[model samples]
Target: MNPKWLTRAGLCALLAIISLAASAAPAGPPRVAVTDLAYEERVSEYFRVVSASSKSSLRASGRESERDSDDAYSRRSSGSLNARSESNYSSTEGTYSYIDRGEMRKFTADIKGGLIKSGRFELVQGKPFTDTKHTEKLYDIIARIKQGMYPGADYVLFGSINSIEFRQEANPIDHTNTVSHTLSLELVGEFSLINTRNYAIKSSFSAMGTGQDVKLLTSQGGRVVLNRGKVVSEVSRSLGEDVARQVEEQLTGVSSAEERDNSYRPRGESVREEVIIFK
Candidate 1:
């Protein structure tokens, strides 16, 4: 046993541990350019009609010729006539309009924040996509990256709404019944890994979420009035989690490597319209 040799060995071991620690420490979360999540305004062909019956007065006009009654027997029968009547139909239509884009923007930001906090990846905060009105393009991400928003991003994530629909059906018996309106949102996500040196897509993957029912409401008047923002928020949250999980699986090789040739696979079944209420 040589005490001097043991001390030297301990010093070397300490230096080696420090080096490993430095190498393992993350520089930061992965820089991601999430395109503005675009949404589509989808209209449903299904419609419901409600009818109500109420008592109301009606006016009628009549014309008579006095000469036609010349041979009348002078017998007049006094009776009342009942008639089925209808009034001018009046209707009002209502629907859920797109909520503030800020909600969705904040949602994605929070998702990124959560992923970073989980210590999964270093998240680089870049400008939020403000163009919520147009089809997403890869150039947008490249343009922002070139502009120094994301100086050194390792990947880019983008998504779009394939369709969003809400439908309601009224009960035949109850004319004034409440109809269930189910909100289904389909989101498609695409990921591209960057080389950082050449900024090329080293690897890419795509996933989709279909028939995801985010919210439900009762039809009011002739329209369904629900909080679209809230629905989008919930859907976005789920979409983010699902996409992150898929990406993680791809990175860790947990699931089958996404088919590069396919590039895209149907994520889930089309969401079926749900009946929240019969009336």
Candidate 2:
């Protein structure tokens, strides 16, 4: 119970508190809120062709005969002969057609669902907004953030469908008796991140995947079936994964979860500044 011993114990307790505070301080990984994750109707193309054939037959027959005679001395000569001809034939004709409605809906839904399942951030739903000249929606988003719809969110995520185009064309070669149908889905994604605190953009990125075409034949008296949902799902999943990876890299300077968790403050970086600059 000496006074000097008590002073030493107090000093030890203070040192422990300081160490705990230092350890508990946030190292990296900013708490982010992802807003506006709705499906934007982009270009989706789907086409299917079905073909059928019909056949007919024909037959024809014919016969002919001739006779002649021959004699000696000053007479003439003669002969006899018989002949027959017959023909049988068959013919076939085929028709080709297609339908492309349900595929579009399936594709759009697939993309929306895939992005939501990527586990990047807290996905929030907002009113629909088209990419056309519409500043009202943007302002509404800002107002919502200010009204505490999202608390402690550091950033807002917004994106647009720059283009969604599907090109479909089928060519039938008369000499080859073959029909080639090509279907392509091209999508472009334009994304921007805005700082919720200052309502300023943090980063902007764009990615596009095009020239994906599926070719099939429609000659063998059958229908070529394609699942539009599957194709869109794949493309959407790819786009979402790429976007998530890029965003993580820009925000945390790392591409993977492990790197994000183990990241430390750079030698001189005390505060991470928002890199998005408005023009």
Candidate 3:
């Protein structure tokens, strides 16, 4: 065989193998967009209350009467004197009250801050749906985008705070006015993934997270107390992250399944065999 012919044949075979490999290559990662989480209908401002106990004591009651002898000092200036009387009374009572921890505290938390572009998908920050009536805006935004847009979002994720609970418990440790209290905050959220084109929900799930703060109350000053507002924000952010993470995991799993399916296809086999032959 002519050496030049062999060289040409080898080049043609290599090109064909390269084309086959390209055809079998997995698709690029999907684009995902996240909307600003919506607040539930019954949502209200967050708050906390502080309370302490004290003792009250009252002195005993007393009555006294006094009379003076008129003739005892009758030498120089004898004068009539009226009798005098005095009375004292005392009473005690104990009461407990819940004082509102009255400093208006504020905190800002972004639940989706932990999400970033990562393996198998590109995360995109979309216009947040902050209003109660945000569905119209979201659908309109999706409608404006052209189909098959390169690197365009294939799915949209929506999340909302489903529940928020705040509670405080106080326990007295001993008689010396020593007390301990625990503050708990729980947040629950629901998340949904929708197909961008048809607006059909592909997946839905719920996640929850909790945060707690504890303090010991004492007559001794300078004991640190946890801020209730901060704890609520922290717990809310935690719950949001949990929900977002589950969505990411689901999307990643779907991508992996697709890759697995592709690997078992005949094109995949052809690519593998050609690469091995070339090697």
Candidate 4:
């Protein structure tokens, strides 16, 4: 073979190898960042009323006549009766505060870390971006991602705590006269995933969770308050895990191959969870 021909063949072989390698290698995961989570604690009020009433009455009348001579004897009797009823009503009004911005920030951070640990996507960890102004800044978020503010983030995840409600009430424990109560925290959040390159929303979803700390008050005046933050943290972690799975499913059109084997978990008691995907 001519030396020139050998050179051409060598170049062709190198180009072919490069093409094959590029084709065989899997595409890298999208660069993702979690922005600050926002929540506004608005005052909430609730009112309730209960009422009951009862009444009863009885009356009797009788008449008799006797004949023996003209209009001799006659007897008559009559009675009047009256009844009254009384009603009692009880009304209760309560005012309370929801989770504040700082708490929500913590919750968001936990979620960000959880997603990274889920092994579903590559998440870029950085300072969370919070929306202070009332105006929308979703586009601004994408711009920041494009500017490499989040350090090579191609996709951005943003969320807001839509609402938070706290309820405290008493209940009987295990058929005993002893009373128990629970302070419950319910949170609803809206999350969005954006593609920085095209500004396209890859997914938008809503998730809700509730965390309750129970207190049992015995007849002996003994009481115990379960740590509130513990349940809240568990709930936040659960929400984060679910969101990661949702994003993975939406992006790849399938569930993540990696199995989530977290041994310790909560029962998600009284938590209403929902997810809607918009591609």
Model 1 CA lDDT for position 68: 37
What value of lDDT does candidate 1 attain over all alpha carbons? 0.53
Q: Which candidate gets the maximum lDDT versus the true structure?
A: 4
Residues 116-164 of candidate 1: C-alpha lDDT, one tens digit per residue: 5434465655556455464343235566566665654576554544434
TM-score of each: 0.45, 0.48, 0.48, 0.60
Lowest summed lDDT window (length 10), candidate 4: 260-269
In model 1, which residue pairs have backbone atoms overlapping below 3 Å?
A: 28-122, 29-121, 29-122, 29-123, 30-122, 178-279, 211-271
TM-score of 2: 0.48
lDDT of 4 by residue, 78-144 (tens): 5565655555656666666643343245566566666665555577875554545523443356655
Residue-pair clashes per prediction, in order, are 7, 7, 0, 1
State which candidate has the highest TM-score. 4
Worst 10 residues of 3 by lDDT: 99-108
lDDT of 2: 0.57
- In model 2, which residue pairs have backbone atoms overlapping below 3 Å? 43-164, 68-78, 68-79, 69-77, 69-78, 70-77, 70-78
Candidates, ranked, lDDT: 4, 3, 2, 1
After superposition, candidate 2 runs with Cα above 4 Å error: 1-12, 15-24, 37-135, 138-140, 171-176, 209-215, 248-279
